[model samples]
Target: MNAIRQRIDTEVIPTPGPNPKNPLQARHLDHRLVHDLIARPEILGRLRALVGNDLVVWASYFFTKEPGGKEIPWHQDANYWPIEPPLNLSVWMAIDEVTTENSCVRIIPGSHRRVVPHVPARDGVAFGQEADPAYVDEDAAVDMVLRPGQFFLFNERLLHQSHRNTSSRRRMGLSARYIPPFVALLDQDAPPLFPDHACVVVSGDDTFGLNRTTNPPPRTA
Candidate 1:
């Protein structure tokens, strides 16, 4: 965990601003510590139980909200991803003690039942797109406060967002997105995915051969 924090402090938080090539956006691609976290035995076991045995980690993002950071408007992850089936299970793990004051992720209960329409986000928000305000039930939103090392799972279509950081503390969390190998990922140079993106097969076999696959990085001393 300390190593993860160090990397983010040195490589991610120091960046001038958000970019497609930002290290925090996909640290798992080159960092062994981040890669191993997504493939941890306990995490993979639970993921396998939910999605299936043959799991492919297609994306991993580090969500870091420093004090006074802007809010991420409500939006479904499916709105931004490019996959054949658009099926995904997001594992969001807290690297710091996340709380409502620090803008912990908030989700609308049962919002994954339908895909909501999105529009260009207004200025000052963290994302470029946001779910239509008419469809968001802010009154029913639930805050996901978590302790360090704790994680929660949500579907790709779930309506989730976070408020601007009001407290002095910074909130940092890692989200590892998993999908079955059968779900092909399209567009290599897209916003979320880079040109040479490689998916990691954390469990079972990826017989589908739909997307590029690679072995996990070696453990660092």
Candidate 2:
């Protein structure tokens, strides 16, 4: 966890920018450390039990919330995703001691049952769009407080969000998205996903051959 956090700290500066600035999106593509962590046998074993053996890791992100960072509005992962079947399981691993004060992720219980409507996000939020408040049940929301090395899994359509970092301590977490080979990535050369993007097959065989694939990056010095 320390090594991963060091890599994220070296790769990204918590600054406002177009994309991949503070959150450091998609590092698993080229970062050997991140790629190895996501491909660990223990993690893959759990993922296989939930979804299947064939898993393609198409996306990864470092959610680094510094002091006074903006809130990530309540939203579903599928809202901005571009994949057929829209199936994915996100493994959010904590790199820091996550707490409510530092804006640990929160999720509504059983929110993945149906897709919720979205609206333009209010001011001081991270994402442009957010789940409609009418559909969000705050009373049922639960905070996912975690220590370093801990992780949680959630479905693609699960409604989740994090509040602004009110504490002086910084909060950091990494998310790796896994999907079956049958789910096709609609576009490879696009925002969030760069040109020549290749998804890594983390487990089982890629029998479907629906998306571009690549091998794990070489270990960095």
Candidate 3:
């Protein structure tokens, strides 16, 4: 994690968006972190058990919340990704101790099974007020508090969001997405800004290259 942080600190600049200054947004740090994390046999073994061997990282994002950071509304991660079949998984690691006072992620249990319609993420943050009426059950949502060095791995389709950071200290986290290599992107024309080599699957034989391979035939309506 230190190596990854150093890489981001040196190579990339904090991407500015609708949010205030100090809200860190860095992509492609996965290559550095994966290289470091995969070296750990125990971590690799655990990832292999979950994602199998032939996996590729789909996307990654780092969120660093400055004091008084904004709130992230409830939503599902699959709503942002362009992959088909919605089989991706996310690993969210808390770089700093996170609590309800800060910005701990809240998730709706068993919400992964439901396919929610995509609502435009507010100001590029993957959260919004609108929700799929089909899956509105108040009892299912629960808060997830993570300590520094702790992480949560869950299906990307799970309904989750982070509340505002009311604390004085900064809240930092890394969110990485993984997927099977065979899963093709639904939007071939629109590719992510960062390079794809950042992804590394701990298990499976499949490998990813710079080549852009389209699905044999696009999904039909």
Candidate 4:
């Protein structure tokens, strides 16, 4: 993984601007780094081991924090993902070193089982907060510090948040969301996949579409 990280960093250039999208930004849909990571046989095998053979690349994004970036408010990934059954996994790969000193994702283990009502995001907030008292347990949250190249896989419903990058160095990470091919989009009105239109291989030669049909119909009771 270290080699992979180094290759991506050396080959890709960072974008400019306060929140310039990272190298694998939404606009660079067919970027080589994106293709290398997603289409890698090892990654695909690992994903299949967990979610079975039929899987879909639901979404992908990059997060980078420079000095004084605002805190990513506490929230669950499921809150933003409009998918039914909530059976999805996220692979958070650290492009730059991550530690509590800078910016690292903090997760509440086993909190994935708790279904809390979604609270709308306040002005300038990246994610919504959990208002339910029962779901807010400060002690349970754990900070995940990863060395460049290391990655963590967690359930989409896991309660998590990231703090501001107080340190001088920048922190960067790439996040990829995956789901079984059977899962369905809960919100038909949700925005199109990042990059608007691009050919992303979710399964075999099938390119990802704005509104693609699922293999096994969404399990709606």
Per-residue lDDT for 8-91 in model 1, tens only?
Answer: 677545653223457577667666777887788879889889978999998888898899999999999999888989899999
Identify the superior model by lDDT, candidate 3 or candidate 4: 4
Better-scoring candidate (lDDT), 1 or 2: 1
In model 1, the runs with Cα more than 4 Å from the true position are 2-20
lDDT of 3 at 84: 72
lDDT of candidate 3?
0.60
List per-prediction Cα lDDT, in the order shown.
Answer: 0.86, 0.86, 0.60, 0.64
Candidate 2 vs 4: which has more lDDT: 2
Error of 4 at 97 (Å): 0.4
Better of 2 and 3 by TM-score: 2
TM-score of every candidate relative to the true structure: 0.92, 0.92, 0.72, 0.75
**Candidate 2 lDDT, 79-135, residue by residue in tens:** 999989999999999989999999999999799999999999998799999999999
Residue pairs in clash, model 1? none
Indicate which candidate wins on lDDT: 1
* Model 4, residue pairs in steric clash: none
Q: How close is candidate 2 to the true structure, as a TM-score?
A: 0.92
> How does model 1 fare in lDDT?
0.86
* Candidate 2, residue 148: lDDT: 87
RMSD, one per candidate, in order: 2.6, 2.8, 7.9, 7.2
Please list the residue runs of candidate 4 whose C-alpha ends up more than 4 Å from where it truly belongs after superposition: 1-28, 121-124, 128-134, 186-199, 202-221
